[model samples]
Target: MAKYSDEFKLKVVKEYLTGKIGLKRLAKKYSIPSNTAIRTWVAAYKAYGNNGIKRKRSKEVYSVQFKVEVLHFMKQTGASYQETAIQFKMNNPRLIAKWNQKFLEEGIEGLQEKAKGRPSMSKKSKPTKQEKEMSREEQLERENELLRLEVAYLKKLKAFRENPEAFLGKHKQSLPLNSKKKDSD
Candidate 1:
């Protein structure tokens, strides 16, 4: 995909908005690759005015509250990812989709951005402010997920201790068990 400067996009949008030409002719005249780009620009301009035509930076950090608000609006309106991104002024719609996936799998906690590299501090020493303020239901859900994970880890550890050879078998994908021998009558 090609990047268009705000000036170029605004020019195309202004030409289209003049009512003197349609999108196809305007795109050809301006040498824009996609007529869809013009249409999107027009829609964005109409919806958000000059700011809509301005290009967003390639990468941005969104707050968890912002992510949650977007998700809630999406749920309330049943809007598609593209629609949500447009409404929220995001250049790429896939971001809203990834946020939605994280929200679904990990709840609001998943929306927060994690540290990029190795952590200097351990999370176990103290609860974060967010954790401290968590509602009772939210806390229980988090604890439940943690307990389930711990159980699975213990189960795997037990299997590894019991049958190191079978556990390391090619089908380790399933569980730690080796095929038991069948006794013939």
Candidate 2:
């Protein structure tokens, strides 16, 4: 998506507010690909004023349950992604569309947050301040997920230890290559 400066957005919004021209004309004048952009801008501008057109500095993280609720509301009301976002006071409407797509493709689990950035090469780092202040329910949910992972890991470890050859054969993707054969004494 193209990023427009705040000045450009304000200009377009002001022109739109004049009621002299429609969205299509404003879009063509600005050489924008779609008039939908103008419509979105207009809605945001009317709803939030100058702050609406301004770019967000930090990313907002929504809870999985919140995403589910948003999806359900959209489903129940049959509202467009933009409308749903505006109702929820969210700046980015496209994220709701993305969540809907993920939910369709992978069920509720798809809405779960995936780890961002490169995986740690060392020991697990301590939780962030935000995580530290997580609600009791959230903390328990996180702990449950972690415990499930640990149990699965231990089970696989046991299986590998019991019969290395069979376990490696069964789970080839877990290891890139087999170890070289040991020399006989």
The sequence of per-residue lDDT tens digits that candidate 2 reaches over residues 1-185 is 44898889999999989999988899999898999888888888888888878877666667665576567557755789988887677767889999999989987668777987898674647766776677666978977875664465557657666786786456435321221222322
Per-residue error (Å), model 2, residue 25: 1.5
Worst 10 residues of 1 by lDDT: 175-184
Per-candidate alpha-carbon RMSD to the true structure: 19.7, 20.0
Misplaced by over 4 Å in model 2 are 122-185
TM-score for each predicted model, relative to the true structure:
0.49, 0.64
lDDT of 1 by residue, 53-128 (tens): 7766454666554565567557755787767767665655667889989978986668767868786876598877
The CA lDDT at 46 in model 1 is 78
Candidates' C-alpha lDDT = 0.69, 0.74
TM-score of candidate 1 against the unseen true structure: 0.49
